[model samples]
Target chain A: MATLSIENAGKSFGDTDVLKDISLSMDDGEFLVLLGASGCGKSTLLNMIAGLEKVSHGTIRVDGEVVNDVHPKDRDMAMVFQSYALYPNMSVEKNIAFGLEMRGVGRAERKAAVEEVARLLQIEHLLDRKPAQLSGGQRQRVAMGRALVRRPKIFLFDEPLSNLDAQLRVEMRTEIKRLHQTLKATMVYVTHDQIEAMTLADRIAVLKDGRIQQIGTPSEIYNTPANVYVAGFVGSPAMNFFEVTLERDGDQIGVMLPAKLKGVDTPYFLPLPAGGQYHSHIGQPVVLGLRPEMISQATTAAPEDPVITCDVDVVEPTGADTLCVIRLAGRGAKARVSPAFACEPGDSMEFALDMSRACVFDAETGMRLYG
Target chain B: MPQPKGGSSHRTVLDKLSRFLPQLVVAPSFLLILFFVYGFIIWTGYISFTDSRMLPAYEVQGFRQYFRLFAMDRWDVAFDNLLVFGAFYITLSLAIGCLLAVLLDQRIRAEGALRTIYLYPMAISFIVTGTAWKWMLNPSLGIESYIRGLGWESFRFDWIVDKDMAIYVVVIAAVWQASGFVMALFLSALRSVDQEIVKAAYLDGASTTRIYLGIILPSLRPVFLSAFVILAHLSIKSFDLVVALTGGGPGYASTLPANFMYEMTFRRNQIGLGAASAVMMLLTVAAIMVPYLYSELRGKRHA
Candidate 1:
């Protein structure tokens, strides 16, 4: 219903800065996610948008009006909290109708609205019951119902699924995404779970410390992270890093592989990150980032392809795949392979190193190069 | 090798006995409570049916003294006085306590100092505190004269003296002495509240007043119930303060059931009527609590 824009907003508590010079905007009907780990200032930024927190500098505008000085009530927004925050003393129906009642909606209309929301949430039978009487997931539905009954200009959700059990969280996540689709409301969701961000967000803003690391769609952040932190923080089983050096093997440049990199006994040469990207630091230190699935059982595409040889340190079969541990670059690295390779702890395995797809990063700055 | 189960079973039994033997050895204090508290209450009730004087009298007088008690004007005044006291004390204390807790809930500067000042009265014994309050409320010595001495020429804080207004003075003292405990109770509940709930309400466009009244206050139900029970108990059994401050004077204007019972049993020597009145008071208190107890117990069952 409304576009929210924040311009160079910053927050500091006494001496320590919680959020710094943050600027972001969301279009109408977009579900923007503020995804970050704990203490990354994502919640602080959300609070600033909600008017629960004051920004030390800059301005925030909603629907093309400067709302920096507006009160939360006057800002026209609804929020669903992580704890659900259902009124413990009120019935489920009353909880849903509270916002309507506060806005002076007529009794009959409020009743109809509450019933509609209850039916939509599939919690009609729980109308008469108090919040304490309902289960965690049901209470969460009531919390959303409380927000849904009123068509506020903006909807703010602060990790609303965190309190539910795993199964309920998944179910509620789907329900919330569906609700957003149906309502087409402007919503901002904050979460520490990347899966939730990847599944639900139209565009995810990855944050760290007090700054945005990257802002883009899920695929862009996963396929091309701006930094090593972004690349490592966005994926599961996490991308592994191997410290290497840039070397010139004639006109084609590639990073020299360590002895434990399997197939090549002497040296392994992969494409030296495109162009003169790392040419300045030819012999300097650099780290290689590779995902688990990238290195699999060797295929017969090209026999001369860069392959690594290593002795398997351990093998773990997870029904779907067998996770094998081996020494690569003199450090432990895990390779995901098919369950067919019934390798044991002491077995030797021929694992190919897919350096072409592997990301490269500067060791000093932790920024991706040719990622 | 021989089976070790039997030997270990004996050792386990001995171990359990050794562990709990200290608890069994410390059972006398429990019996002491059963005798001194429960046994004495039964003895007091038994004495209520007898026409006892200064010494204990075991002769039956049927219900003669209870009938006389019903006719006494002082007893009537004492009954009315308790209702007045209970109404004013509980309501005033709750209002003051809730307001204080709410104000302190805002991140105030010197919270510890304010809390100590509010709660200091609870630590003082009502017998002594009541005496001090009596001296302070005395028309000539305490506040009335001091303010009048400032050349007001007309000042009357003499509610402690007037028959109609004397009970209000007792109420003032009760609320003053008990509000601190209520404040502490409310403060703890407010502190334990999920802070994100407030933030959620803020984002939901609820005003600060609405957040406090609609969201915060409703969440304080359990604490309110506990404070209500404690304040009610304080109102009904308010003996020492009334006896010390007003002396149940101004023609029994500040008297409560406990004070009335003491007056009949000790001063008037109407032992049988005093016991009956005490039992009646107990029944009345129980009557007030029955619905509450039923609801509380039923709530537990439903849970």
Candidate 2:
């Protein structure tokens, strides 16, 4: 395992910058995922790290040595492509052994390494089959086997599970996490998939438009997103954003939501947890971000909890929890309630809004105001 | 709507006609190919069985013409020439074409211009290629004279006039005319190879040479088979090139089967023997093409 540090790395094609000032460092055996939407330059940054693409600016250091101009072959990094990219002409055994052979490993050692990887991946039976003869999941296993056999200093995966079916994607995602845990190899995975990043990354660097939006642990990213974008991107059904005017009520700070939201005639004053960061925003419009899980059925209605009656617009049952679509502040917001407590579409239900974990963003800048 | 019953019946007839239109449009070409290609093949096969000397004859010969054709020394030379020419032509074309294709796939500048230049010879007719090479191979008129004028007095290049070496000259001309087409085919297949595979190989620590030899070229086996089949048929039916280049000269040393058939049927007035030779050429082409086509179609079905 090796430590990789990219200092102010930037890439440009002509005038169009594909990645701008991307700088993140990973400790040895760290699983750092570059998460972003397509065209966000996550893959570009991964390629830069792998030496497949030039950094264009700044320096890439591996184990404290500058390797900016190094060839990909000399970089000691193995990449798993999104397409699996098994050599169609080679059998599974050869596909895994090819890297070792290229590195001048002895024939007997190569065979031993191939067999060990195959046994670890439970693909020993598939060693003699060509890539075309394997199913999609089997190909994915062989791809991982190929990377695993190299035992490289760094592993780069570019959306490796995106091509698999949903069921297989999940299976392989878990397998990758297990592989990372077992080997403790320094890995840089790039994908647009947030769930994969949440489950697998030791630290996730959420990127947008060639710039990193946030870099944080999974819990930090979920419970305390760095900005409005990260808040909406990480959660299923997405976090809800409400444009509201923060008001001061004699040492208590809160926002008054539309009374019609709960089918009530008068407005409801919901108190936000007090903080100096939010005090300056009183009497100014701010975007309030709340995750769906934070708003749940008020079954036990603790005295400190604030409850709001909502007109359930639609109910989506996703097995464990039912999502109720409700209108709040003139826009629809999803509220997660237990399936047992979920009400009908036309009915009104009471939801406990967890203001303790709410995120408030500056309306003009879309930056996080406070917790 | 008012005349519903009759109108519905008329609509059914129109629908039927529309469905039949596709088949109707293709019928003429189908009939033409059937009569001109397959019909002539059948007619030739029958003529080979008859003792049709100097003209068409209905008298059964029962392999008499075939025995006479095989016994002829001229036919022996031509058949031997075909084997030499076909083997050399197919092997050289595939090797040269694949090399050119691999070179052009390097994302080099001016690739379009280079590809067009390499493929330009394929656009010329084989007969034209043959005549042009004939002039160039002429001892007094072409390279030998030019080199001698350039102070190389002892230089002599006269393969076109040499009996043992004349077939090689045809091989060279045929390869020049067809290697370009083979290159075009290989280039298209090379372009369609998944680029990610190359990148994966690069990251696998494979050198450029190893990547191409171990991974890329081996994956192009189907294209190699296709090129082989096409060049095999072209070599077997090579008639015009030899006729224009050597005219089976130097005592019939460069005559292919097609040229032999022409000489026997029209010049020697041996129709039955000529038909037998033509049938043999047909069988040779079929032997190469049938298996290739079968495997290709079978592969597609499995895919």
Which prediction has the highest lDDT against the true structure?
2
> What digit string (tens of lDDT, one per residue) describes model 2 on residues A228-306?
9998899898999999999977778888876344466446778887545677777999898989998889995566778
**CAPRI accuracy category, model 1:** medium
What DockQ does each prediction reach against the true complex?
0.60, 0.80
Per-chain TM-score of chain A in candidate 2 equals 0.97
**Residue runs of model 1 more than 4 Å from their true location after superposition:** A259-267, A273-277, A300-305, B1-26
Candidate 2 residues lying further than 4 Å off, grouped into runs, are: A259-266, B1-32, B149-151, B297-303
RMSD of each: 2.8, 2.6
